[model samples]
Target: MYRYLEQRLAVRIMEFLRQRYPETALPAVVIEQPPKVALGDFAIPLFPFAKPLRSAPLKIAESIRSEIGSIEGIAEFRVAPPGYLNVRIDRAWLALAQALARDHVPKEEATSGKILVEHTSINPNKAAHIGHLRNAVLGDTFVRLLRYAGREVDVQNYIDNTGVQVADVVVGFTHLVKKSRPEIDVLAREPRFDYYCWDLYARVSQWYAQDKQNLQARSETLHAIEAGNNETAAVAETIASAVLRRHLETMERLDIEYDFLPRESEILHLHFWDAAFTKLKSAGVLTYENDGKNKGCWVMRRAGTGKSEGQQAEQALVQESGGERVLEEEDQKVIVRSNGTVGYVGKDIAYHMWKFGLLGQDFGYRKFYRYPNQHECWISAIEGEKHHPHFGGVAEVYNVIDARQSEAQSTVIEALRELGHNEAADHYTHFSYEMVALTPRCAAELGYALSEEDKTRPYVEVSGRKGFGVKADDLIDQLIVSAKSEVDSRHPELGDEERRSIARQIAVGALRYFMLKYTKQSVIAFDFKDALSFEGETGPYAQYAVVRANGIFNKAALDADEFARNVANKIPAEEFSQFLNGEATDEIWELWLSSSKTSYVVNQCIATTEPAYLAKHAFQLAQLFNAFYHRHPILSEPNEKRKQFLLATVAVVRRELTRTLAVMGITVPPVM
Candidate 1:
């Protein structure tokens, strides 16, 4: 309702302004909420138009207030101090419309084409850690927000099967563990293969530190895997595919789903990089560096440096420091090393080109994994099934990568622009976010041996190479155990299976909400106690509110939908208006007002590319509903009309809260 009225009023005021001042160029009309509800529902400032109209802001506000006769949902317009125009909504009309679940907002026009979201592109080498969870949850929730806002979206999880990370694991099995291809294949088929690899990867890192010569094995293994059709490549594939499956299963515990899994091996086997290389060379996007440490390598200017600008800067450096000091100026990124192996950024550029449908080549698709609901997740292949869903060719693409990859992501976008795919470059979005760290208490609870210095720090950063991080599956299992104990102590009457199911819901909710409650730029310090707490701003708290709302209907033996129908049919608009306008019922009206802003809050979240806003909205809504729940008694009240009105309030709060949590990928269990 707030969004609808805001949009309506903005359009009406804009049209009025253009007619009033025909020669003046008008600015965008922005609608904001007043600080206090008593002031008005919407606030618009006329300061922006003062210079254009050659009039004082106060005079402009008065002119708008007097001439802008009436807006549909607005009851009165007042000229506040300075240049503000405040609008009071028709409270009774809004209350009645909301009670009936009637939305007067017009449908938004659909975006031009499909939006491809790439996230959770973890290296297929080890078990996913807490850092990976933050990436996946943020990406998954953003996808949900886009879908909720009526956009066509495709979710992708890129598999780096041929990267150095996988090569290290391959080295660990072959060299450190002395396992053959057959032995590794057998081990990959066993349970907890990713966990085994996790430890082996850490061992390999230590092995390299012991002797620098041991690093040669990693290079050789990486080359063999990229060349494919060999024993080493087969072993890498077996391990990567198995670990990738484990990753999907872990994410599935949180109800995260993907539509495609594009593998790097397929990118090599299908000649994606080769095709992209041809385009880059033809467009002069790549240059051969003949000297100064990058001899024999093909390079490109870094993201913000254009070709001419780079040349001018290098010339200036040469003039200032002479030719001998030129080696110190490192302004170019090597696309192909002197050894002729393509860098990660090169392949990433090719992959992004494919994402935007600019790469004429396509990948072969085959079904790789299936969820319990039978939603098949497809993967790229050399020779795939004949009939498969089209995977690429999107109008826009968003890569949910970590902030550390900002440079590489920017290079990809710059390459697109240089190649003259300007529109595609403009639509490219790098959803960068900071990493997650464990609080000292959380690290201690995970049984890690923390040094005294580490314990005193605010957060303890985990290193995958050191095998010092909490695995995703391990964390999920622990959360479920904690939640189950809480459930057992509180609801012993429920059966074991039912209690376990509810516990799973609560655990997943807590984990996902903890991941999403912070802004993308804010680093999350994961703590088990804070996430599971039921009294404060946590997922279980919101879940408990929904549960309590449900209990109200359960005890009264009344259907929530039927109660809403009763309010809409039995109560008069004037009576609801009087009830809503009464000073004694301000808190009740505030609950309804908060409930009405779910869509408004969703739009805010989408516009900002941040799910934290929605998380805050859900928490605030829960707080308001809890306050209303305690202050007003529904079933025990003797006033029939007031009781029904109260029930109607509960029904709306329950529905909106449930929907909001679902958008964050959090579920409200029947017994939280």
Candidate 2:
């Protein structure tokens, strides 16, 4: 509702300006919320128009105030000193509109094509850790935000099944553990297979450090896995498939789902790189390095550093120096090594080209995993089902990777642009975020031994290769145990299973919210106490606010929908105005205003590619409702109209809070 009013007013102001200043050019009008509610609901600065109109800002403000006729949902406009237009909305009308409105799903805008969001691409070698959790949760929440905004989104989780990580795990099982294929198969069927591999992976890392000769095994295993159809490749497939299943189960605990899981193995066996290499050569994006440190390799200029004139000048200088000049290797990124192996960036470029339908190749899809909700997840296969849903050819793509991969992501986009797919390159997004580390207190609580230096530091980075991080399953289990203990103590009357279910909900909420509360660029130091707290900017705090609001409706013996209907039927706009106006009812009015901005907040989140703003929105709305609950006596009011108005306020807040939490992948338990 707030966004609607802003757009309406902006259009009205623009139309008025065009008619008044026929010869002048105008800029886009932006609307902002006032600092205080008493000032007004929305503020529009007139300073930008002064230079274009060749007049003082105060005069422009006066002209707008006089010429801009009455707008819908707006009560009046006031011009402040110097140059500001303050808009006061009709409170009664807004309250009535909100009470009568259904859910706050924003209207879908027309889009050119489907959006592809690739997230949670954890390597299929070991158990997922807290660092992986941040990637998955951020990606999942962004998918939710895009879907909620009425965009067609395809969720993908890339599986690096044939990568060096998988090769290392295979080496661990065969060389260090000395286990045969059949022996490992039996163990893979056992519980916590991924956890077993996690420890083995760390041991392999240690073994490599003890003797440089041991590194040769990793290289041999990688080549074997890439070749396929051999015992080593089969073993690699077994371990990666098992670990990938465990990953899916862990993410499902937090309500994250994917539409497709494309594997690196298929990309290799299907010759995706062969096709991409052809295109790169035909487009002249790849150049052969005949000399220098990168001799006998296929290289390309780094993204944003491609300057033909400067390259020609450097080459001329080198020739003038009697062909003895050495080319700077740092300015070039190697796409394919001299040993005839394509680099990670080369494979990624092929995958992204497929994503935009420029590769002229498609993955064969087969049903691989099914969620409890009956959603089917497909995987890339050599021979897939004859009839399957299409997976590629998207109009836009978003890769939710860590900040460390920014350069690789940029190279892929640069390749796209060089290949003349500038539109796809322009639409590509690297939704990068910082890593997650454990706070010193959190590490100690998790029973990790810390050095004195580590203890003094603010955060401890998790190293998967060293097996020194919190596993995703273990963290979820620990959270549930802690939450269940609290639930058991607080609600002794409830059955064991009911308490357990509520605890799971709370635990998942805590985990997802903790992952999302920080901005993408901000590194998070995970701590149990901060995440599970019931007060102050935590998921539990927001969930509790919803539970408490529901309690009000329960105590009044009224269904929220029926209460809204009664308010809309019994109360008039004038009565709402009388009830919501002045200093005495400022808090109630503020709550209504906050409830109306859920769609606005969602739009802001999508535009900025940041979910932290929505997290902050939910927390702030929760804070306002909690304060209002303590200050206002809703059910016991003497005046019937005022009581109905207050109940209507509760209904609106309850609905919006629940919706907001749902979008963040958090569920409100029946009781907290």
- Global lDDT of model 1: 0.88
Candidate 2's C-alpha runs over 4 A off are: 102-108, 307-327, 444-456
Any residue pairs clashing in model 1, and if so which?
Answer: none
Q: List the residue pairs that clash in candidate 2.
A: none
RMSD of each: 2.4, 2.3
Candidate 2, 91-196: lDDT as tens digits: 9888988888744343456556899999999989899998999999999999999887888999999999998899999999999999999999988876789999
In angstroms, the error of model 2 at 539 is 0.6
In candidate 1, stretches whose alpha carbon ends up further than 4 angstroms from where it belongs are: 54-56, 104-108, 306-329, 440-457
Error of 1 at 421 (Å): 0.3
The stretch of ten residues in a row with the least summed lDDT in candidate 2 is: 102-111
